[model samples]
Target: MSTKLHSAVEVGHLRKVRRLLTADGANLVNAGDGLAEETPLHLAARLGKADIAEILLDSGADPQLRCRCPFVNKFDMNNGRGDALHIAAAFGHASVIEVLLAACEPQAPDADGYFRLLDLTAMYGHVEALNLLLERCPMDVSVRSQALCFALEHAQIECARALISSGVDVTTPRRLYRPDGKGIRPLQFALSPYSDPCDDHILKTEEEALELVKLLVEAGADVNANATIAHRFGRYDGCDEVSILSCAAHYKLLKAANFLLASGADLNAKDEKGWTALHVAVASGNPENVRLFLDAGASHQVTWNICTVLDNDNYKFTKKWTALDVIGMCDTRILDLRVSLDWKKYTLIGDYTEVIELLVEDGADIEAKHETRYVGNTLLHSACSIANLSAPAGFKRSEFENGIICMNTTIQRLLPTVAAFVKAGANPNCLNRFHETPLHVLLSGVMNAIETVSGSYKYHHAYNWVEEEEKPSIQLLFQCICRTVRVLASAGADLN
Candidate 1:
């Protein structure tokens, strides 16, 4: 009898549904289907039978009646627990949603407190259903805030606009906790390069993301709102008061960055750690964004800015690191400059070159010492150390020998970059706090690579000339290292 009513509701046979309800021995209006345990009204709501849903509701159908279906994926299960209102919201059945709201607790949420009925509609991009729910429902400020965040998280732009226009506070932080244990604002979420990994929604395209950002900004979201969550995670530096522009620079969100900048974001807003957006741009290896910040009055000479640095003993000191220092540390991580067959030929062709040239042209002190306790080295010292530091950990001498030819080619390819620093008047012979010159740093890296490879499995026994067969490859690597040493020496790097 329940199956018959479900079939009638599923097929939108309102007369049959009414007769089933009004008959002398009629099954209850809230009767569950056999397998899914979805009630008759659940079928009506799921199938968009508004009139049948009205019939069921009028005949005492329980709007708050939850189905007993097993949890499937998010879209399959209604907010991980099936309910008639959730079903109607998920299916965009506005009329059914209105009827359900009239009969049920309008403020009721699903099992997850974050997912209210409005959130379900926003998550599925059901704008009409969302509109009806928002207009007729009795949501408080917090639930409305969650609904807006849900819309933005799923890239439901129209729904987001609707929520914002409906007076949901644009500044309401997301209830979802970041690794930093703080809630992120809507602007921060929109500017983040990737959405939360656990979220089922894919990040929107750059244009749509930019549009969302513009919407929020136009709606009075603080453009310089600090992203404490990004700061704590320290993907960039753990500067606790990072702003939206800094976050945009860190993630290389080009369009969103431009929009923020053009929208009059603070150019030199420093985090609590004294790191600015420029510092973040340099650390993120985005020369273009770095240039953008500089063009907007970010200081090229804010070298004395200090961040808390911890030593090996876990003691902390305030240390000064310039953008140039950041650029030096970031240079070798540019994979194109390291892996290209013609990277040597085109050493000045990439973004690293652009950044170096920009810094040089902007009068950055090319000879500034990176004054950290570990190694107070110059730019040249940092660069040379970085060049030969690419050997994989625990690599065997045989593997190094087998790959010696390619290694030599890579060294040859990297020489032009070393030349660029020299041309920029980098003092190669400048000593670090440890009294080690750039030559010493470069040689130490090479010797470390050689030792790391040499201590691995022996390719020959004492009585075998297999050692002799391997000698030339080792010799070739040494020759390449010596040639690099000579190149540095020619640039005034001291051999002694």
Candidate 2:
């Protein structure tokens, strides 16, 4: 008989519930449902059926009757087992929440020992429901912290603001309700790029997110809070204690970055890996952010440059690399800057030409050489190597065979980049540790290409005409090579 009443209340059949309650000796108001062991009132509140919930309450339903369900360990399901108020709050049932709170102690936590109604409502982004509960009961310090952390993690702006206004410590590091067991403060979550949960919708625009950040800052949130989460789950290496400014620069949150900068964030703050916001900006290929950092007077100091003296021999000084050296080696093909790989693979290619120009214009050592096992190549050498290895585009074999040499294509594509270095006074004859110049790097790449193509014909004796067919392609390749070599030579390269 109680089972029938439970079913009626679950589907919001108010008349059926009233009928069952009026039956002879039917005591079913607080009877636990077969599944999840939720009482009839729990079912009504969970489904946001205010009429059914009110009827259950009127018929002596225990509003504080806890659900006998296992708690899900995920952030969204952190407090799986709860009472009528918890259920109503989790589902954003404002009317049902008011009914449940009237019959129950509002500040009581749920059965799982994790969430109060405030925490549950904030986690699920139930602003109205949360407001209803807050009006009746005061949130304690611990509960306020938990609610605000959940609110920030889920991007629940209004719920977060309410918690903040109620004096929740924004800088307090609460244990994140994930399997990894790391503690993250509210400000760190706000700075995170992956804060948006799959279930809840909050902070739709950059402007909205920035406003929330301002609110947190105004509420005494730490702008320099360190991120304790590991980066192993993603492409970037997770550091032990990365600052919020580094996170902003890494994720390219321009407005947030500017705001943090304006708020007196430590511009020179280094993470556990010894990276500042400038390193992160350059590494992430965000030239705009890099420019911002530079414009804000971010130090261009690197580890190697710091150790070496300016009065040291030019050759010895060139051995130490800097951010400019890292930019020179950025791979043009890969779009994602956060991918884990060799630091030398962090170049921006042709896309961020303005950034490269900016770095040079702002006094980055244009002729800075990278110390490697094979060579100590400068930025100019790196540029030449990239151009030499890049595949020729839009070249037909017949055009080469017809003696149509398109030097303009080479000039238009890559020569200007080399010219930028030369115009900035790059030493065309500058030798690496192996005594090889930029011309030597270009020649080696060209030779390798020619040798690879020539070896293909060596095994083909029947196709004598194949040599003729190969002539145009080889000529075209050599044409680009010669034009580049000519540009370097004209720029005062050592021919010998």
lDDT of 2 by residue, 1-496 (tens): 3388877876778788889888821457767666667778877876789988888777788776777532233344333677777777778889887776668887787775667778778877888877776777776787778888778766788888887877778877776454555566677667553443322333335565577688889988788777664432222234266678876776567898999999989888776546677877865657788889999998665632222223334433323445565454412221122322222222232344565677777778787766643467888887677333233221222222111112222322345556656766789999888788998887777665565334333433245443444332455556666777888989999898
lDDT of 1 by residue, 1-496 (tens): 3577887777778778778888822466877766567898888877778888887777887777787422224345433666788777777789888778777776676655445678778877899998988778767888888878777766889999998888889886864455544676888767653444324344677777788899999999999778654321223232245678877776667788888988888888876656677877765557888888878778876753443435357667665667666555413322221211211221222235566677778879888887655678887776666334344221223432323323333344335445657767788888898899878877777765565334332332242423444332445456656766777888877666
Per lDDT, the best of the predicted structures is 1
Runs in model 2 with CA error above 4 Å?
A: 1-7, 22-39, 57-82, 102-115, 177-182, 196-204, 233-239, 302-321, 326-350, 372-375, 379-431, 435-496
In model 2, residue pairs whose N, Cα or C atoms come closer than 3 Å (at least 3 residues apart or on different chains), thus clashing, are 231-238, 330-346, 330-347
**Which candidate achieves the best TM-score against the true structure?**
1
Question: Weakest 10 consecutive residues, lDDT, candidate 1?
Answer: 337-346
Cα-based lDDT for every prediction: 0.65, 0.64
Those runs of model 1 whose alpha carbons end farther than 4 Å from true positions after fitting are 1-37, 58-60, 68-79, 175-182, 193-195, 199-201, 230-239, 303-316, 330-351, 380-496
TM-score of every prediction relative to native? 0.68, 0.63
Whole-model lDDT, model 2: 0.64
Q: State residue 448's C-alpha deviation in candidate 2, in Å.
A: 17
